[model samples]
Target: MKIALTTSGENLEAPLDRRFGRAARFLLYDLKNRTFELIDNAQNLNAAQGAGIQAAETIVRAGADAVVSGHCGPKAFRVLQAAGVAIYNCEAATIAEALELLKDGKLQPAAAADVEGHW
Candidate 1:
C-alpha cells in the first residue's frame, strides 16, 4: 500500500505534522517496496486559503492509497474520500510509529472530516 504521511522532514524518523494542509512535507511510503519518496509541500504551506484542497489533490495525483495525518479538514477530506483514499489519524507520532499502527491495523479510516477548513 502507498501511504502518504504528513511529516516535518523527509525521513521516517521525522515527527508527524499536526496540520495536514500546512504540513511541510509528505513522505510517500510504499509498503510493498519498502521505499520512501519525499514530496515537498511548500506551495500549499503558504496558501492563504484552499490549502487542504490543494494538498488533497497532490496526494491523489501521487497515487496515494491512504493518508496518515494528525488532522484532515473538511474540503480535503471530501476530496480524498471521492478519490477513494483512506484517511487515518496519527497525531503527535513519528512517521515510523504511524506506519506501525497502519501495519497493525490499529489506525481506523476516518468516517468524516475531523476539522473545519483552513484548520
Candidate 2:
C-alpha cells in the first residue's frame, strides 16, 4: 500500500502540515517496499480557492492508497474516496509520527463534513 502524509519539509522529522490543500509536501511511503518519496504540493498550494481536490488528484495519480492529514474538505474527501483511496484522520506533527500511528492502526477515517455556518 502507498500512503501519503501531509508534511512541512523533505524529511521525516518535518512536522505535519495541518492545511491539506496548502501543504508544503506529501511524504509517500510504499508499504510493500518500505521506501519513501516526496510529492511536491506546489501547484495545489498556489491554486485559487484550493480545496484539496487537486491534492487528492495528485495523490491518486501518484498511486497512493491512502492519505493522512489533520483535516480535509468535503469535496476533496469525496474525490479521494471515489479514487478508491482511504482517508486517515490525524493531527500528526511529523512524518515518522504519522507512519507510526498508521502502523499501529491508531488512525481512523474521519466523519464526513457538514456545514457549520450559513453562507
Candidate 3:
C-alpha cells in the first residue's frame, strides 16, 4: 500500500503539517518496498482558494492508496473518497511516528472530513 503523509519537510523525520492543503510537502511511502518519495506542495501552500482540491488531485495523480495527516477538509476528503483513497488522522506527530502508528493499526481511518473548507 502507498501511504501519503502531509509533512513540513522532505523526509520521514519531518514534522507533520496539521493543515493538509497548506502542507509544505507530502511523503509517499510504499509499504511493500519500504521506500519513500517526496511530493512538492508549494503551489497549494500559496493558493488563495481550492488548495484542498488541488492537493487532493496531486495525491491522486501520485497514486496514493491512503493519506495520513492532521486534518482533512471537506473538498479534499470528498475527492479522496471518490477516488477510493482512505484518509487517516495523525495530528501532532512526525511522519515516521505516524507511519508506525498506521502500521500498528492505531491510526483510525477518517469517516468524514474533520474540518471545514478554508480551515
Candidate 4:
C-alpha cells in the first residue's frame, strides 16, 4: 500500500509532523516494494489556515492509500474520512518510523470527523 507521512526533514529518522497538510515534506512510501518517494509540500505550508481538505485531496492524488500524521484539522480530517483513505493519528514522524507502528499493529484507525461543517 502507498502511505503518506508528514516529516520534519528529508531524513528517515526525522520526527513526524504533528500537522498534516502543512507539514514540511510529504513522504510517500510503498509497503509492498519497501521504497520511499519524497514529495514537496511547498504549496501547503500553513496547517492552521484550514488547508486540510486540499491537503487530503493532494495526498489522494499522490497515490496514497493511507495517511499517517501526528495531527490534523477538522476540514482535512473530514475530506480524508469521506474519501475512504485510512488515517492513523498521532504517529511518529517519518515514513520509516510510522511503518514500524503499522508493522507492530500499534497504529490506530482514525474515527469519523468531529466537525459540523462536513458535507
lDDT of 1: 0.91
Q: Write the per-residue lDDT of candidate 3 for residues 1-119, one digit (tens) a residue.
A: 99999988888888988989889889999999999999999998788999999999999999999999999999999999999999998865688899999999998899999999987
Model 1 Cα lDDT, one tens digit per residue, 1-119:
89999988879999999899899989999999999999889998779999999999998999899999999999999999999999998764799999998999888999999988865
- Report the candidate with higher TM-score, 1 versus 2: 1
- Displacement of the residue 106 alpha carbon in candidate 4, Å: 0.8
Off by over 4 Å in 2: 114-119
Q: What pairs collide in candidate 4? A: 15-93, 16-93, 52-76
**Where in model 3 is the C-alpha error above 4 Å?**
none
The TM-score of predicted model 2 comes to 0.89
Ranking by lDDT: 3, 1, 2, 4
Model 4 ranges with Cα > 4 A deviation? 46-48, 91-94, 113-119
After TM-score superposition, the amount by which residue 1's alpha carbon in candidate 3 deviates from its true location, in angstroms, is 0.8
For each candidate in turn, the TM-score is 0.97, 0.89, 0.97, 0.84
Clashing pairs in 3: none
TM-score of 4: 0.84
